[model samples]
Target: MKIAQICPRYFPDIGGVETHVKEISERLVKAGHDVEVITTDPTGKLNRRETINGVKVIRFRSFAPGNAYYFAPQIYFYLKMHSFDVIHAHSYHALPALFAALGKSERRLVFTPHYHRSGHTAFRNLLHKPYRLFGKVIFSRADSVICVSEYEKRLVEADFRVAGKTVKIPNGINLAEFKHLRALQKDEGIEGKTGKEKTLLYVGRLEEYKGVQYIIQSMPELQEFRLKVVGKGPYEAELRSMAKSLGVEGRVEWLKDLSRRELLKCYAGADIFLMLSSHEAYGITVAEALAAGTPCVVAKGSALEEFVDGTRCLGVDEPIKKEEIIKLINKLKDMKQNSRFTTESLTIFDWDYITEEIENIYNN
Candidate 1:
């Protein structure tokens, strides 16, 4: 089977959707299916066309100046000219995905909307209205609509009124990799932090909507733990200022652009993983944390709440109070110390299982 994955961005641009496309596309290629990715060169630096890990990637010039929502007209033309067994579009908020939906293709159109009803800021929220109007038409075009979480599926059904042919297929992790790391992992504490101070890890783009500010705000009350922030984004400067203003700058360490191995080690070593996003389609890092046998505390109303079974994971509502976060952290730490912490079974998130499900969608 020949498959075309249409997304706004691809490799080297790290995010949940990018990682999802890369993992499934590579696995599909390994399974003897021909796979190609069509995305935009947001940075204008990546090769226009290249084959990586047996999967072909084609990036077109795009007009994505600041915000990640790219505008690529060529993708529509490319879709009209090419033929494939499946045309899988990702991220309803991105224009390239919308264009892929609009393009005339006889192939079965499988769409993973990655939908979030609103955005982080008022401006982005305003922009969502137009995107939603566009997405209604895109949803109509999909032969099968793939949602990453139950929350996303509900939003798609409620907002777009998508009835049948909508499937809930959550994002997956490389279970083998995490298992290997767990096997060989040593108790190497955080790279620089001394003593056995509890380690709190936040790994993802440091965007404002990600709710990193809430964590930083709570640091004044959480002086016992060291916060290690991984990943870079536009919101770094503001977060830094907030940390300094709160006089907790010394407790927070900002690490950016870590390699995959280093990141897994961080997940393995951290005492607790924090994903306090205001809006998340699915918290892939939370799954990664669980796979590493690390406990997680996610935002209450986000899609992550569905995955947290309250054993190794906990959820707190948005605008989370400092005292509440501190209490949860303390509870998780006690649970860890008592050896009573057990992560949710993450076999559902294994890439092998996830890819098989995606293959079935394409075949059907």
Candidate 2:
């Protein structure tokens, strides 16, 4: 089968959608399928056409200033010219996905909206109303629509009335990678840290909707823990300012663009992982944390709630209060020594399992 994956951005961009496309595409290639990715070179620096891990990646020159909602007219022309067995489009809100939907393709189209009705700010939320009308048309064109979570599936059905075609298939984690890391940690006799000054980790884009600010606000109270933020984004300066204002600057460390091995080390060393995002279609990082044997504190009512069991995770209300966060941290501290933090039940999110499910979807 020849599969064309349409997305706004690809490899080295460091986003959930980008990671999803890379993982599934590489696995599809390994399974003897001809896979090609159609994306935009947001920086205009990456090779326009290249093959990575047996999958061909074609990046169009984008006119947009930043990576968000990239505008690439060439994508439409390419889609019209190319032929494939499957046209798998990601991120419903992205322009490339819209072009793929609008393109005249005879292939079976699969859409993974990665849909969130609103953005981190008020203006984006207001725009979502009109976007819903456009979104309906996109989903309506697809042979099948994939949602990463039950929460997301409900939103698609209720907001866009596309439930009949929508199916739940979650974002996955590289379980073998983390298992190897755990083995290395044990062999090296490297336990995270022994006493006080627990390592608290937050890995993802530094964005307003990600709720990194609330974690910074709660830092002054968490004297025994040191916060290490991984990943870079526009909101870093603002978060740094908040930490400074709160007088917790010394206790917080900002890390950006760590290699996969370094990231797994961070997850392995973490006493607790924090994912307090205001919204999440599916928290892939949460799964990664679980696979790394790190306990997580995620937002209540978000898609992450589905991934947590009481033994390994604690869910707090959105706009997380400092009091509750502190309370949860104390609970985690008390249990850290005894908690197993195993990934035994997270096999469902293994990339191999997820890829097989998607293959079945494509074959269907």
lDDT of 1 by residue, 1-364 (tens): 9899999988888899999999999999999999999999867789999999999999998887456679998999998998888899999877987888888467789999888889767787888887777888788889999999999999989988886979998999888887687454654443422246778899999888898888898888887788999999899999999999999999999998888988988888788889988788898998888888788888888787886777788889766877788888888888877878875465456878999999999889
Each candidate: what lDDT?
0.85, 0.84
What's the TM-score of every candidate structure?
0.95, 0.95
Tens-place lDDT per residue, model 2, 297-360, is: 9888768788767768888986578788888877877776666444466644788888999999
What does candidate 1 score on TM? 0.95
Candidate 1: lDDT of 63? Answer: 85
Residue-level lDDT for 137 in candidate 1: 79
Please give the lDDT score for candidate 2. Answer: 0.84
